[model samples]
Target: MIFDSLDVSYGDMWGSHQGMTHPAPLSRAVAARRHAAGMEYAVLLSSRERPLALVESWPRGKWRVYLFDDRSWRMQMIDFKPHRTGMLLAHRNTRWQFSTERERSSFKWDVQETTTVLADGLVEMRTEFAGPRGASTQPLHARTSDRSSVGPEPVPVRLFPAPVEDFLCPAPEFGDWQVFAPFLAQQGHEPATTVVLNDVSVDEGSGPLRATEIEQLFSSGACDTPDGPAVVEPVDAGLLRITSGRLAVSDPGWIGEPRTVAVPPGEFLVTLSLLRTTYGVDVAAAKVTFSDIPPREWEMALRPDEDLGLLGEGEFYGVGVDTGTVAFMDATRAVIEDELDEDLFIPLDGRFTVELPGAESEPNLIAFRAGRGDGSYPVWIGRTDDGQVGCVVVDFQLHSSGAEE
Candidate 1:
């Protein structure tokens, strides 16, 4: 769905009109607005109008970014793909330059314009966003040789958002969510059904956890990890090794540009939600707790700088579990990339210690099985009653389906 627009000045960067040429006439500017043109806005002015800023992405060569507002009402994201021909190559990249339409503007990139150079014959050069201004404009030559070539086909980088109506859900009142375990329990269905999402136990914590269960979920051959001689050594000391690592989660099998997170640094307690169904035991979700305080307002686990937004019934951001697996490690190390999806049930890992190359000590990697094989899972940031981060949770939505995988 069309989630974002970088708010670029609409230019005819793509598409051809009848008898028209590149850079379509200004009258067709509306059509051009849907282009991930070779540009990024230094600032966005219409803040009140476009408040939906929630970015999301997948590994299938598609990029979608969203940014949420403070009130946490709506979301916005920009998704586009690169055309094989070099038409929108610049626009095809994942633009991490984020904006909340606020005062500060830090958008940076090479603002390129073609120029004829008699010294090097007809040569094209590029310049910075501001360097090209002033009377003494210094045309900065590219660090690499020019690659201004196109293929036979012109694949338009589809930079557009889906209709807002597409996001409308028959959801309940939006905002901070309560512990849903009680509500889900009320919907009694079958035996061994994946019921537990949040801690439904007698108010104590979720677990002390067992090594056997951890192995089945995270240390199995199905999950690729560091295994040479000490196969289950990490599982033996899983809990101790688990919490000592990073707060960020990751999709170990993710295919494209690695999706990572800069997590809140602190000591975390690792716990699992092993929900049993007719298909056998499954890791429904996983929890990494930092404080005993229950989350007063749960927000999507976005980067610290991302503006928080209230989510509706079916909106979130987390890691994409493509291999039916997800991992949690230190964020500073870029060891994990993640998504914290909703649906409180948990599970999912077997933590192991591995001495990574160039690293001093062995950092823990909590790899766990995702609930429903592979899909985007949301990681929820549980804030303490006092608005502090108490925990981080990734829900697999096992209960949503009928005791199935």
Candidate 2:
């Protein structure tokens, strides 16, 4: 028998097969051996420096292979047959090649079946053989019949369990309206009718389509809208003031003459051509809403004044991981001078959920916890590589076990 049932029986569990003699820590040792068997060499062609590394076994087999990029986590496997001399490569839907002692030239071939076994497996599969060219025409005969009485039973397909159901993180809901950052529109594959953000370096969309005009308007904050009195007032050199609603500065660096824009009641759109500080020239747009106030009741709802300091650091900084809103502490002496008696909500680790506006997007909320109430907020906002913005809250209490202090 080529394989001893008591030694290398792979498929299912039987009586004595489970009784393989293993030393102390047997389970871990066995797991480590299996893990080692699952490792394979991969050469990442893109990177110049450290281009080679040991990756999980390629879907193909327990051997070495080359990949153009080390990007995707999942991969497809390639099938092969070991020849009597070395190895015969079989590739029809694969982008790889192989070599052996019998062939020195590189060539491509359609899928084919060859009556060959590994150079090592050949020792048992060959009949008559020469000195160096070990096996030739004849194949070794097996005494056991293909339908032997003691042969393993044909395993039913139902032996394997069906794949686990895919997990979908709970989507976020909005009471009325919300704002969203840029995210890639995965179109139909992910969520189409819901909020979707763009996060791709390439300006072109992922699927076969062009970005919507709304996205273009948001990217370059400049659009044509009917004139109205400006409700925002410039408070200082670096800050501006909005009375009650949020301030949407299309151009961060665009500082024009101080002017007022009277916003109408109910749903309204305010467009501007703002400038960014860093890049030479870039513009984006923002949409604001005042649902409670009716269009005709604009004068009664006008609260056109602001504490300019709110427009600075806290406006763009200290974004909560879950809430998708920028929060900051009133650390300034001015607010404390008046004895505001408000809780100084400093950034501590916290998480909140967010439903990006416009396109269908996943709900990203925020959560954070404190470690001994360290006064500092644990949650902070950061930009992803694809321009998608997100937040993360940290809890110091949970980290006590690993704390160096």
Who wins the TM-score comparison?
Answer: 1
Candidate achieving the largest lDDT: 1
TM-score of 1: 0.35
Instruction: Name the lDDT of candidate 1.
Output: 0.36
RMSD of 2: 27.3
- For model 2, the stretches where C-alpha displacement exceeds 4 angstroms are 1-49, 53-93, 96-265, 276-282, 291-405
Task: Quote each prediction's TM-score.
Answer: 0.35, 0.16
RMSD of 1: 22.3
Clashes of each: 42, 53
All predictions: root-mean-square deviation over Cα? 22.3, 27.3
In candidate 2, what are the lDDT values of residues 317-349, reduced to their tens digit? 111122222221111101221221122223322
For all candidates in order, the CA lDDT equals 0.36, 0.21
